[model samples]
Target: MTAAKKAQGPVLTTRALNRATLERQLLLRRHTMKPADAVAHLLGLQAQNVKPPYYALAARLDGFEPEEFSALMASRELVRIVTMRSTIHTHTADDALALRGLVQPARTRELNMFRKGLAGVDLDQLVVRAKELVEERPRTLKEIREALLERWPDADPQALGIAARCSLPLVQVTPRGLWRQSGQVSLTTLTHWLGRDDGQEAVPDETVLRYLAAFGPASVKDFQTWAGLTRMREVFERLRPGLLTFRDEHGVELFDLPDAPRPDADTPAPARLLPEFDNLLLSHADRTRVVPPEYKGRTWLGNFAWSVFLVDGFLAGVWKLAEDKESSTITFETFGKLTKAQRTELDAEAVRLLEGPLGTGLPYDIRYEKVVGA
Candidate 1:
């Protein structure tokens, strides 16, 4: 059914999609938008780890300082939570509640896989207890799990723990997500953290528009894959009248806001260094717009997303950053030969990164560990 649908839209080139992805992502050029605004604009930053959100912003925002971004977390204007894809994202307080509401069904459905462990356990009571435990003070997941086990002694310990996660809109408390800080993830209810009623329910209509603005010229499958939900074609259909549509090389129908930018195929996309698990690499069902087909799965190693770099607007290499008291180093492990011009661009970008958001008051160096084909 999906394939058949892909064969139907008006044909368009992938380069158009590439430039649009970069532009929508703010990689078409750096912007002066505030970090909190950027958090809302991109919907949220993929935050499987603490530092990615900072690096993700550094790549797309002009004059982005990690301190400014981190300050939002310190101020609670931004928070880290499990949202789309059941992965942690750094989101504005309002987006946190609304998106959680939007995906509540899916998060709840995640519990079905643990049904065997949840058997005979009263889930409604579990929600109440879990909410109370966290609100009294932020608690670690292990602590939450053990607490659950105390009540449901006979239930699968792991299942009870997961149920607690699946059943709540828990936010990872501060010191956990703040930059340059190290702390275990502690959970609490979003309402408790924000001191307000949960925001309006996640409306598919609003989410559809936002998704297109950030990730579109995309297909339904792309949205589902990024959102960690399924069966959303109905939402797209309802919005079709106002949206402009195009087809990819595979004839996959893509939708976008009517006035969205669709640059010509020959536009020059500058080099960018993106942090691991950046949404740009994960948001699309057909990632060929940013990741070439030949490099499929090259971005990972044993379930880890290597910090990747874009050359000419596609995943061209992966990079690693290492810092010590005496110096900081940026290393590139390329996937293919890079031209002299590309190397110079990578060099300058690395320095801009190290001195700007990453300044450590230490010497900086750049190396090419595996410039494939070089």
Candidate 2:
């Protein structure tokens, strides 16, 4: 049998996939890499909410100071922009530039979904005018939409706003994503914000390799889902000679970089706290690798994505923080029974999360709430 066939016979069990993913995600043990490096390695954190990236890096990096990430944003070395499913993410400046062009197709699809609402509006003019407004200075969505409406009063205002966002490479300005700081979501063109005169665009093959490096041994479907781009089978096929392949227990073909980390299934993974919409949960087509089926649906309550924590590298429960002037409290809601030892480890992790990355410097409490349905 060929080597590929040899590697395929043994099915990778769920726990095996779980352990391998945890190791790749830096959740098995914290690494000493710089925060920006960590962000790049993980292919950017799912950062619809500003604080998730800080919490995500803290969970994956050793001695992580929130300021390290904030500093990158402050220096424009890192940026927060809409990419990968057209959601806000904190990406290294390099990624913000390259990946944005690659995902333009996905953004165009996003605009198509609102085409009915955008009838009678000249989209070409909208893009030009939108660029003009924000390129001058960062403008709030409301401000941009109101201005667009003046020109296209018969068009759907909401659709006009979405059109601008979908058409432009808008970056959420600092203080918006800065730690412990709050500001309205403001936007400016990536070219203006980054001051890049040289033309650069997304390279799909490079993006595929990066995805594998961070969240891989994944199926093409997994990648398409994470990227919000479709018809990736051809891309994977083109790179097949340079990639390694394996099969999960369910017989799905999985792809990976030839030299990427794939730790032994028995590798130990510690407890970790993850913010709402953490990339780990959202980056896969089959989340069975990181989320047990029993606990899967619990992460979402209606439309809200709850903050969560991991025990033994698998999602154990959902978490929320309640804070007062004097103290902060973490409310952990578990889907099933956790061992006494797991609870202890989770508590310790929570404390570190609050005092360290959270930087609250206040006394805190961790409370457990039993899972209602599960």
Candidate 3:
């Protein structure tokens, strides 16, 4: 008889999948990794709105200084560009490039939304002019629009600006995204920012590898959802030779790196405060892995605006901040029961988020009240 083949453990349940995701995302606990490394692991930070992920990393790492991330941006180790979902994000220079290649379909979809506004416009002509407008000097959306107006005065300036936003390969000029300071918005083409010709080929396989490396143990649907792109079946098939996968109890397929860490489902996840739009919370299609179903509607709010929250590796409930002139207070309103100790733990975590991670320098009035009162 042939020797019995070594057996892997039983297939992970959705809960198990959720747990693995939380662990990889640092939702299980704040980690000691640098912001750049964390950004790489989670694939990239969602930076459409700034200030959130800086707090996200501060909560995750020990003594995380804001300047480290700013330096990364300045040095071009990382870049703030409109890429994934055709929205602004702060990503590693390489991830930005790869995502640019991966998200073409999604960008195309967004471009269609502006078709009426950009009717009869020559996209190729726009690209050449747009590139010239920002090659050496970074210009604001208004400035770029004004320049375009001289050539295409018949077009709506706002529409032309929005068209450039969707069709042209642009990046926010630096100092706009620098840490600890706020500046005016300006645009520069991707090629000029990265100092390389933009390669427009589809790199679905490479994109898949990067996704699994950072936010893996996830399903193809999760990847598709995260990338905002469809038609990834071929990419997954081609990458099968290098990936390991399992089926959830629901039988949805999940994929991950062979060597990626899978902590036990019961790993002791500490209370964590996440920044709005943290990648961990948004990387999956089924967010049940990190966010509990009860509070999903409250936190997500259907629009781009996001709220901070508390979790013990699993989604506990929604959190929000209300600030006054005297102090900044964070209220933890839970959808589930919390022991006295858990409440205390959550309060301390909240204080740290405000005083340290958020660097608000304002005293905090933190509290955890039952969701429905009393």
RMSD of each: 2.3, 1.9, 3.8
Per-residue alpha-carbon lDDT of candidate 1 for residues 52-148, written as tens digits (9 for 90 to 100): 9998999888888888888889888899988898889999988998898888778878889999998899999999999999999999999998998
Candidate 1, clashing residue pairs? none
lDDT of 3 by residue, 1-374 (tens): 11111113248875677667766666666678878888876677777766776767776677788888888888887877877766678877767776676676687788677777666678789877877888869999999889988888777778778777777667886787787678788888777888986555447787787787667787778888889988787788767767776766666677778898888876777777776777777777887777666566556556755555655666676677876677887877787788888787788887776777354686778776667631
Is 1 or 3 the stronger prediction by TM-score? 1
Q: Decide which is better by TM-score, 2 or 3.
A: 2
What TM value does model 1 have? 0.96
**Candidate whose lDDT is highest:** 1
Candidate 2 lDDT over residue span 122-164, tens digit each:
8999999999999888999999999999999988889999999
lDDT against the true structure, each candidate = 0.89, 0.87, 0.74
Lowest lDDT block of 10, candidate 2: 1-10
lDDT of 3 at 373: 38
Query: Model 2: how large is the Cα RMSD against the reference?
Result: 1.9
TM-score for each of the candidates: 0.96, 0.96, 0.87
